[model samples]
Target: EDKVVQSPLSLVVHEGDTVTLNCSYEVTNFRSLLWYKQEKKAPTFLFMLTSSGIEKKSGRLSSILDKKELFSILNITATQTGDSAIYLCAVFNSGNTGKLIFGQGTTLQVKP
Candidate 1:
């Protein structure tokens, strides 16, 4: 069975603090892993890591994938109170099913 797990299910931090969120997964015919940030209604796309060791960055957020170890990490630097939200990790398999398996997600709260 395919599964994904995220560590530190919830976190509390002050503004300007840097945080590292972890996601590990096991899936059949792995394709890629994606990260998203959910604040109010919709979850915004953050990063998609495909190749191992190659990091994907967007503004203050960055993520990297490790295909061999079957894990990924998302890093946010100089966080702001507005950054508080639920972060989701999802995996896509190489099957034609076109399904995205998601983790329970990590809730992050940044204090001002």
Candidate 2:
């Protein structure tokens, strides 16, 4: 079965801490790695990393995928209360599009 796992299940930050979120996976034939941020309802897309070390960044958020190691990482700098949300890691299969298979997610709590 293709599955994703994220570490440090939850986090607590005080309005300026830089945080790194880790995600690791095991799949029969990996295709892509995706990141999402959840505040309410469904998660909003963050990054889709297919190459290693090459980070995709926007504002205070950045992410990278390491296909060699079968893992990915997300970094958030200068976190604010607005940044508080759940981070989810997902894998996309070229053959499947039913819905995104989800990890339990890493909940981020940024205190003001």
Candidate 3:
């Protein structure tokens, strides 16, 4: 079965700390990788990476995909208390179903 795994299931850091979150996967007919951040409401789209080695960025958050290694990393620099949330990683297969296989997610707590 296709699966995705995230490391350091949970993390706690003081404000201004930089963090690296990992996501690895094993799937058939890989298509793209996606990252999301969930707060009080819903998961918010962060980045979608299709090409390996290309880093996608938004504000202090950035992510890169390494297809050959079957993994991806999300980096957050100078994090703030507002950055506390659940970070999710998901992948889409090349199949026509358009369904995304998701990992359990990494919960982050940024203290002030």
Candidate 4:
């Protein structure tokens, strides 16, 4: 069975602070590692890492994969209160089943 683990299950930070979140996984026939942010009921896709040594970035957020180590990291810079949310990491197989094995998620609270 595929599994994902996220470190620092929860975090509290003030505006302008930067944070780093981590995810590690063990899976058979791993296809990709995906990052998502959840503010409400739905989760919004942030990045999908299929190749190692590639960093994906969007505005104040960025993520990178280390396939050799079977891990990934997510970074948030100049954090605002709006950045408060639950960040999730998931892994799925290469069989194209559209099934994802999700991590417990990291809850971030950004306060002004």
Q: What is candidate 3's CA lDDT for residue 79?
A: 95
Candidate 4 contains a number of clashing pairs equal to 0
TM-score of 3: 0.97
Tens-place lDDT digits, model 2, residues 1-112 = 7788998899998999999999998875567889999998789988888778898999999998888888899999999999999999998766555345668899999999
Instruction: Give all TM-scores, in the order shown.
Output: 0.97, 0.92, 0.97, 0.95
Superior by TM-score: candidate 1 or candidate 4: 1
Q: Which RMSD values do the candidates have, in order?
A: 0.8, 1.5, 0.8, 1.3
Per-residue lDDT of model 1, residues 1-112, tens digit only: 8999998899999999999999999998888999999999999998887899999999999999999999999999999999999999999987878688999999999999
Which regions of candidate 4 fall more than 4 Å away from where they truly are? Answer: 95-98
**Candidate 2: residue 19 Cα off by (Å):** 0.4
Question: In model 2, where is the ten-residue run with the lowest total lDDT?
Answer: 93-102
Per-residue lDDT for 30 in model 4? 88
Instruction: Please write out the lDDT profile of model 3 over residues 39-77, one tens digit for every residue.
Output: 988999999999999999899999999999999999999
Error of 1 at 14 (Å): 0.4
Count residue pairs with overlapping backbones in model 1.
Answer: 0
Residue 14 of candidate 4: its Cα lDDT? 97
- lDDT by residue (1-112, candidate 4, tens digit) is 6789999899999999999999999988888999999998899999999999989999999999999999999999999999999999998876657578899999999999
Off by over 4 Å in 3: none
Error of model 3, residue 100, in angstroms: 0.2
Instruction: Please report the candidate that would top lDDT against the real structure.
Output: 3
What is the lDDT ranking, best to worst? 3, 1, 4, 2
Question: Which pairs in model 3 have colliding backbones?
Answer: none
